[model samples]
Target: MEQSGNQNITDYDLIKGSIAGDPRIQEILYQRFAPKMYAICLRYAGNNDDAQDLLQEGFIKVFRNLEKFRNEGSFEGWLRRVFVNTSIEHYRRKVHLNSISEKEEVGIEDVSVSVLDQLAERDIVQLVQELSPGYRAVFNLYVIEGYSHKEIGEILGISEGTSKSQLARAKSILQKKVAEHLGVTRK
Candidate 1:
């Protein structure tokens, strides 16, 4: 599809152009999605440097595999999944793999309330960054990305128990942070 002078190029057009090695269209796609995807990386990375690294790596993968995007779902969703998986892959590469005992994993219950909702997205991101890599990965996958422990374990190359344990620890840490922010403690 030729780029019209006045009309915004659709995502499909950019994807097609990118796959055909059109650098301008590729740049257009990158500018369109990079900001949103960077936020995803930041949530998983715990810092700007790591998030920037993941952002670059994820875009590299996206461009390399753009032809494989089957058009079955929203292109943005597909890109977000790729970035999220890329973050997990990076985490696994850096962290030691270990099995966690069942007893150590905490059970997650649906809370009637969410303090995180009260905080700005940036503040929530900062709070999540305070967690260790393992805990942060599990938390982002399970809490933010809506992955199950089993799915997270498979992605991170850990047992389901380990994923659960890490998520529990992350929640505990986050809960304390939230409590501090609220000027209260868990009863």
Candidate 2:
């Protein structure tokens, strides 16, 4: 079949085709959203491998619940939410977020603007990757994913305080990593 070069395919059309069980349309939808959604998953996942897993899992949820979308907003927004939730679900399944301690949970406020300016996007992503899974999850969820501590805790099956602690630890670790990269020592 001839593929259109990123033509403006309406969500209505895509949804119709998907509901009709047209495999080609489904593939097209996947191709369209996968790259952007994969990046979202990557931010939440601790490593590239886990990111890929979350990407697949997220896509699965997207396809499975495609019909439920109410067309009240941008399809991309709806899809993005699915991918985010999928990433959170993946973490919840793999980690006991509830087990975090107050010392382990880090608040996000400690992450400084100066530090962020010192690093590029890729550098920040790498710093996040270096964090332990629990710290990384809370950091990504709160900082990157814009989830509240309460939401992060609920998603991870941990208390809000644990999420706060994890985020703080994540910030401290990231600051150290960034400082090391910049040849600076903390006072």
Candidate 3:
């Protein structure tokens, strides 16, 4: 596929080029989506190195499965889903979500909404990264990716209640981190 004069390349073209093993199109596809996909990977990966690994693994899967795409919806959405699932798979291998006993649960007071309002997105992402892998996985799935507790449970191999509990703890810990970052004590 030759780059025509002054016309933006469609994702269909990119996918086609990539399937044909055109390095130029593969490189173009990577250049187009890597940043957004890497951000998603970073939310689930604990650190930069792991995030890069997820990015690499995800793109590998994306290229390998590009032919499976049915053209039913957004290409970017499909790519995002692949990246998120790759991150989840990475977390799944590293940590098992052992159910926490109720007696060990910690309570956290809800902070003012302004706390999140005050923080930059990078600050919020950093706080999320500070979470343990189990908490981070649930938090990313439910909170960021908009998967429900039931869906998250199925994906992570935990019960729905456990999914909810992890999200609660993740939120609670995040609130404290945000409070500390903002120099405001949570009551």
Summed backbone clashes in each candidate are: 0, 9, 0
Q: Which candidate wins on lDDT?
A: 3
Each candidate: what lDDT? 0.84, 0.79, 0.86
C-alpha lDDT (0 to 100) for residue 181 of candidate 1: 78
Least accurate 10 contiguous residues by lDDT in model 3: 105-114
> Which tens-of-lDDT digit does each residue in 13-128 have in candidate 1?
98999999999888888888999999999998868999999999999999999999999999999999999989988987887644566664555542332787787878889989
Report the number of the highest-TM-score candidate.
3
The runs of at least 3 residues in candidate 3 whose Cα sits more than 4 Å from the true structure, single-residue gaps closed, are: 1-7, 102-114
RMSD vs true structure, all candidates: 3.3, 2.9, 2.9
**What tens-digit string does per-residue lDDT give for candidate 3 at 60-167?**
999999999999889999999899889988988888885786555444333333478788999988998999999889988987899999999899998777787888
In order of TM-score, best first, we have 3, 1, 2
Task: Return the lDDT, model 3, position 24.
Answer: 84
Every model's TM-score = 0.87, 0.86, 0.91
